[model samples]
Target: MYQYDEYDRALVFERVAQFRDQVERFQAGELSEEEFLPLRLQNGLYMQKHAYMLRVAIPYGTLGARQMRTLARIARDYDRGYGHFTTRQNIQFNWIELEQVPDILQHLAEVDMHAIQTSGNCVRNITTEAFAGVAADELIDPRPLAEILRQWSTINPEFLFLPRKFKIAICSAREDRAAIMMHDIGLYLYRDGYGQMCLRVMVGGGLGRTPILGQMIRQGLPWQHLLSYVEAILRVYNRHGRRDNKYKARIKILVKALGIEAFAREVEQEWQHIKDGPAQLTEDEFRRVAEGFEPPAYQGQGDDELEYGSHLTMDRAFARWASRNVHPHKVPGYASAILSTKPGPSAPPGDLTAEQMEAVADWSEQFGFGEIRIAHEQNLILPDVRKRDLHALWRLACEQDLGNANIGLLTDIIACPGGDFCALANAKSIPITHAIQQRFEDLDFIHDLGELSLNISGCINACGHHHIGNIGILGVDKNGSEWYQVTLGGSQGKNSALGKVIGPSFSAEEIPRVIEQIVATYCAYRELDEPFVQTVQRVGLEPFKERVYARAPEVEPCAI
Candidate 1:
């Protein structure tokens, strides 16, 4: 929600103009595909399996209703009728024409959004908790810091071409909803014992071919040095991070090679010279950024009866939806409603049509504040909805195909646009996701199972975040045939842990059954009301592995 100043506007406008010329040169045969690859990537344009994909940054996953409407317009005019909301809380249009990318960027710029830094080996979008401002348990709002980082990193000459893509996340809540531990740089903002705000900084966490949890480089860093400290870390990595091998280019690989202690020392050495420099945040700058995110005016109706129970009593379907989709808000008589785009059996996860986007925009204005949030789990959030309007909003969302009512259930899958779109994919992830959803269509059955995150990636890139799901499925190719490898016990939270692989790979045909076996094992072995993750952690992966491999003896068994 940070408003773009004249400087920000000029920067984007200049970049758009530069890219427009580049697109012209490419079309004119002056720039070959190889020559233009980095140029296009820097602008968040990727050449996919069938067409170009344009990823637009939704900074810190916050957008106003007008911005949402603009995105809907972009989807309708430039690309396909829908967009895919990604795990990083950005949105991608998978069927964009190469020539129309500049126009798309222009449209985004009009709304103070752009495709800058959404891709490439440079620092990507700075993400944070989707519920930053509104979360009841937050120690500090992270959006101001996220915005500060975004400004500092945008087209930074020193970091424009890093060894690999860098991702940073900031979280202010106790729950760690931002997956802070899995980012290249993660910041946990909290108040110190003396009531002064500070940041806990973690560096070098990422998932790809190699997944590693970030190491804490700095603890209790005063909030004033946020930008300066980040600059120091990036400067260290940009100078020394490997470039000879793409596989070893990430800061995680460097951190792993250097060891945490050495890395922390290097960052500290770098920081000592620069901590109190100009990049050190000023009180006025902080206030300016914070002002943009000032809490919207609320009626402040204390202890008002919401009359929401009537819907639960009158309609079983509504009751089921209310149980899963609605989350408690800190404010009295208010709630955060998750409008699930991951509908089962029919629609692919995170795919939303243009009309649906517009409808959601309308609903956000009507039932909530004129604001929307894109959660990292590929769901849309109306963050400040009145509890009294839940039923009406639910009905409108259901009509718009935006209401699946499965926020944390099995069918609410996180999947990448696999072979259907991504050039790097080994298999089609969407159809397989559909297959699984169709097989487990019962809402009660799914809810009863409870909070199972099934993430599928078409390849080891882990674009779907398979490494962090409760049931992680990664597609692989064996002798030109697509197969899947499963991992379990992974979670993204305050207690974040990477999942361990259960056993051998399964054929595409066998994936559903494999999943069923895994779920069945959970059902059989779980303690009272134990979630799948808790059960797996309690008994270890041995019990589930034994049952899963027993069903398919041909596949080799492996331990986590």
Candidate 2:
């Protein structure tokens, strides 16, 4: 994890004091609601459905055990007893009082954390794969470059106010776990044939009202020019992007209107003058930042496969959990385990109570190094657990309700705090998630289904990344009634695709059965061990749609 220096601490504390004054004025009636809107948003405070919600940034999804403890403490003492982990690798606290937010920010600053750039139309948090440094297949760690981006973008005067919020994701591995294809700017860090690390720059990708995969604007860009190149792209968007309508203000909209070739031309023209400037990263600077993310002191314990395999043979339940939740580590005798937040038939997706948070922190220190990670899928990760301790860790995780083995299965849902907490939501997302979880509570069935991602969003903002889910569910409002629209065949990763709507929206009560019918149709027609998305792609949506809407009257297919 990157520790905050004196400058970082000063900037955060100063912002906290400024926001404290602004909040005091707003509460004292010196500032109107309209006047306080942008100010509050810049500080990551939102006036949600029932109360204020505060989003705190967890940069690159890395957290030290001490920071995790502070988060648990915050959840225990303030607002509610739990917080919602978001797709942006951040956390949101609902039911926060307006006046207490300053104190909260102060508390966060003490731990080298803040709410800065978590919201509003500024470059938001720079995210990447949670398993960056330790992934077995990574070409190079992207965290050092991500940290550089974080430093350069924070309060940069040139882009303090863009037409819309900008999101950037970097992926070091070929697997694309960071969902780089669906970001405003996506960078793939890889070593070229020359053994030089270079970036594959992507532009115009985003999900929301208009979902589009980013086009590769530049390839084999030298590592040192990362900042200058990013600046050039942002400059083009800032100059040419629309401001008349919020929906048309994103860079994706601009890229579509002008076409990628023209967009690249513009960026190239701008880069001509800035490419060799001071903004171009230096080798020394790279080494300085890279030092922060250097591999931890790993012991040469050799392989623990013998002991681990014995435990797997002894316990079928543990084996099942390990199969789904564990990932391969780069080091021998170590593994990265994902602790599923989306347990079946109960607790809301992404909601972790204070006690659960503490338990995770304790477990991270006990089983691995004192470090933890948050995946974009809304799960916790212990990145360096020894293979020998896998059984002990599994046993404790089961006790904490973090032992669900459905990592890529149907029950491991990605959802946002919809109408239940967000004013922008059309319908409540938690109940819908609960309904689907209850319907597919069987682990054997989920595991057999294989590699299914079901994401639900309350509205079209795509906070849940529904557009990329294998089975996407978007909550809709029709004539003041709550309904859910379904989309099938959406996928994230190397072969990413946006899900297409199967048909018209269905009532809340009909969703669980509709999902069941879709699954049943899949089970009936699928080839041996064919995945859900592959089946949908191979057979087309007609069979699943017919089964899902078999009893309904004729209705036009919806698009989202």
Candidate 3:
């Protein structure tokens, strides 16, 4: 994790002080609600349904033990007992008091964390693969460049506010775990024949009312040009992006209107002016930023296989958890372990209590390095756990209700805090998440169903990233009543694709059964050991559509 230097510390503390004054002025009637809106948003504060929500950026989803402890303290002291992890690799506190925000920011600054650029119509948090530096199949570690981009974008007056919120993601792994395809600017880092780091840049990807996968604009771009190229794209977007309507303000909308070729031309033209300018990354700066991500000292016990194998053979429960939660690491004796936040119907997706956060922080230090990572899937990752410590860690995780043994299964849902907390939500997403989680409580059943993703969003804004879930559930309002809309065959990764709506929307009460029917349909038609997504792809929507709509009530179909 990157330690904050004096400059970083000063900037964060100054923002905290400025926001504290702004909050006081708004409360004292010196600033109007409209006047305070942008100021509050710039600081990662939002007015939710019942209270203020503070979104704190976990840049590239990396956190040190100290930073995790600070977040836990905030959850314990400032707001509710828990916080929600988001798809953007950020965390949100829903029950924040307006006045206490500065104190919370102060606490974050003490530990080299902040909420800056986590919200509002500007470049948001720079995210990357959770296991960036340690993934076995990684071509390059993206965190260094991700950190560079984060530093360059933070408080850059040139792009303090864009027409709409922009997100950027970088991935260097063979698998697209960070959902780079769904970001405003997605960079795939790879090495060329001579082992020179390069980037493949994609632009105009976003999910909301209008969901569009990013289109690749530049390939084989030397890594040194990353900042300049990104700036070029942002410059084009800032100059021509729609501002008259919020819905049409996303880069995706602009890209769609101008076409990919024209957008690429514009970006290329802009790049011509800044390609070799001051924004180009230098080797010295790269080394300086990468120092923060130096590999931790390892025990180097590559021969832990015998002990690990014995444990796996002895305990079926531990084996199951390991099979699901543990991921491959570049180191011979190490692995990355995912601590699931979605532990059945007990908690909303991506939520962790203050105690849970503290326990995870402790476990990160105990089982691996004193570092934690937040996955875009709303899970915490211990990125360098030794293979020998698998059983002990599993036992501790089980005690905390974090060892669910369903990493890519139906029960491991990704959902947003919909109408329950957000003013923009059309219906409550938590209940729907609970309904599906409870329906598939049987671990064997969920595992048997295989790698399936179910994502829910309260509305079309896609805070939950429903557009890319294998089975996407979106909340909708019909005739002043809340209903749920379902989409099938959506997927992320190398072949990212947006889901297609199956048919008419169903009432909230009908969602669980609807999901059950969809699962049953998949089970019935699936080939031997075929995953839910492959089955959906092979059998298409007609089969699932027939089964779902057959049982669906004869209410007039609602348009999404």
Candidate 4:
């Protein structure tokens, strides 16, 4: 984790004081509601249906144990006893009081964290893979570059007020765990033939009213020009992106309207002027940032495999948990273990109680380094756990209700804090999520179903990333009632694809059965050991659609 320098601390504290004054003014009738709206948004505060929600940025999803402890303290003392981890690798406190926001911001600043750029039209938190430096198959860690982008974009006068919120994600692994395809700007970092770091830039990816996978605009871009090149892309967007309609303001919309070729040309034309400017990253600058992410010192001597294998053979329960929750580590005799926040209906997906948060922090130090990571899937990861300590960690994790052995299974559903919290939500997402979790509670059945992704969003904003799930569910408003539209065959990764809608939206009551029917159809046609996504791809959505709609006459199949 990167420690904050004097400048970083000063900026955060200054912002905190500034926002505190603004909040006080608004409460005292010195500022109108409309006047306070942008001020609050710029500071990552949202007036939700019930209360204010504060979103705190966890840059690249990395956290120190001390920082985690502070977050736990805030959850325990301030709002509710828990916080919701979002798909963008951030956390939201849903029951925040308007007056206490300044205090919360102060606490975050003390921990070298803040809510800056977590909301609003400015560039948001920069994200990369959770297992960035430690992934066994990683080419290079993308965090150093991601951090560079974060610092440059934070409070940059040129981009503070873009047409719409901009999201940027970087991925360096063979697998695209960061869901780079769905971001406003996605960069893939890799080494070229001469072993020089290079980037492949993609643009126009977003999911809201319109979902489109990013198109690769530039490849073989030198790492030295990373900032300069990105500046060029954002410049093009800042100038040409639509401002008349919020619905059509995303960079994706502009890219679509102007076409990729023309957009690339625009970026290139802008880049020529700044390509060799001071913005170009130098080796010393790269090392200065990279030093923050150096790998933890390893004590194991690569001899724990036999003992770990023996434990796996001895305990079937532990074996099951290990199979699903454990990830390969680049270091020998070590592994990254995912603590599933999506345990069941008792806790909503992506939510962690304050007690659980503290426990995770303690476990991170006990089992590995005192570093924690938040996955885009909304799970906490102990990224350097020793393989030898697998059994012990499993026992402790299971006791804490964080040991659900369903990483990529059907029940590991990704969902937004829908109508329950968010005012923008069309329907209640948690209830639907709980219903589906209850319907498919059997671990054996879910494991047999194989790797599957099911994501739900309260609305088309796609906050839960419904567009990239293998099974996507979007809540829609029909007159005054809430209905859910389903999409199948969507997937994220190197072969990312936007899911296609199966048919018309279904009532809340019918969602569980609808999902069950889709799974049933998948099981019937699936080949030996075929994953649900591969099955959907091979057979298409027709069978699942036919199965879902065939028996229903009461449910009308029409556009919402």
Model 4 pairs whose backbones collide: none
| TM of each candidate vs. truth | 0.97, 0.97, 0.97, 0.98
TM-score, cand. 3: 0.97
**Tens digits of lDDT, candidate 3, 289-333:** 899988889887766888899999999988888888999999898
Point out the higher-scoring one by TM-score: 1 or 3. Answer: 3
Give candidate 1 regions above 4 Å deviation. 302-304, 551-560
Q: Which stretches of candidate 3 lie over 4 Å from their true place?
A: 551-560
Residue 154, model 1, lDDT = 92
The digit string of per-residue lDDT tens for model 1 on 1-560 reads 57899999999988999999999999999999999999999999998988889999888899888988998898899877888899989999988988888888888888888998889888898898778888878778889989988998999988888988999999999899999999999999999999998999999999989999888989999999998888888988998999999999999999999999998889889999999788888889999888988877777755334477666788888888889998777787788899998877667888888899999899889987789999989999999988778888889888877777788888889999888889999987998898898878777788888788999999989999999999999989889988899999999988888999988899888888778878888887788889889999999998788877784343321111
Please give the range of 10 consecutive residues that has the lowest summed lDDT in model 1.
551-560
lDDT accuracy of residue 208 in candidate 3:
97
**Model 2 lDDT tens row, 231-287:** 999999999999899999999999999999999999999999999999999999999
Clashing pairs in 1: none
Task: Note the Cα lDDT for every prediction shown.
Answer: 0.87, 0.91, 0.90, 0.92
- lDDT tens per residue, model 4, 1-560: 67777888999999999999999999999999999999999999998999999999999999999999999999998978999998989999999999999999999999999999888998999999899899999999999999999899999999999999999999999999998989999999999999999999999998989999999999999999999999999999999988999999999999999999999999999999999999999999999989988877888546689889999999998999999999999988999999999988999999998999999999999998899999999999999989989889999999999999999998999999998988999998999999999988888888877799999999989898899899999999999999999998899999999999988999999999898888878777788888888998899888888789975332321111
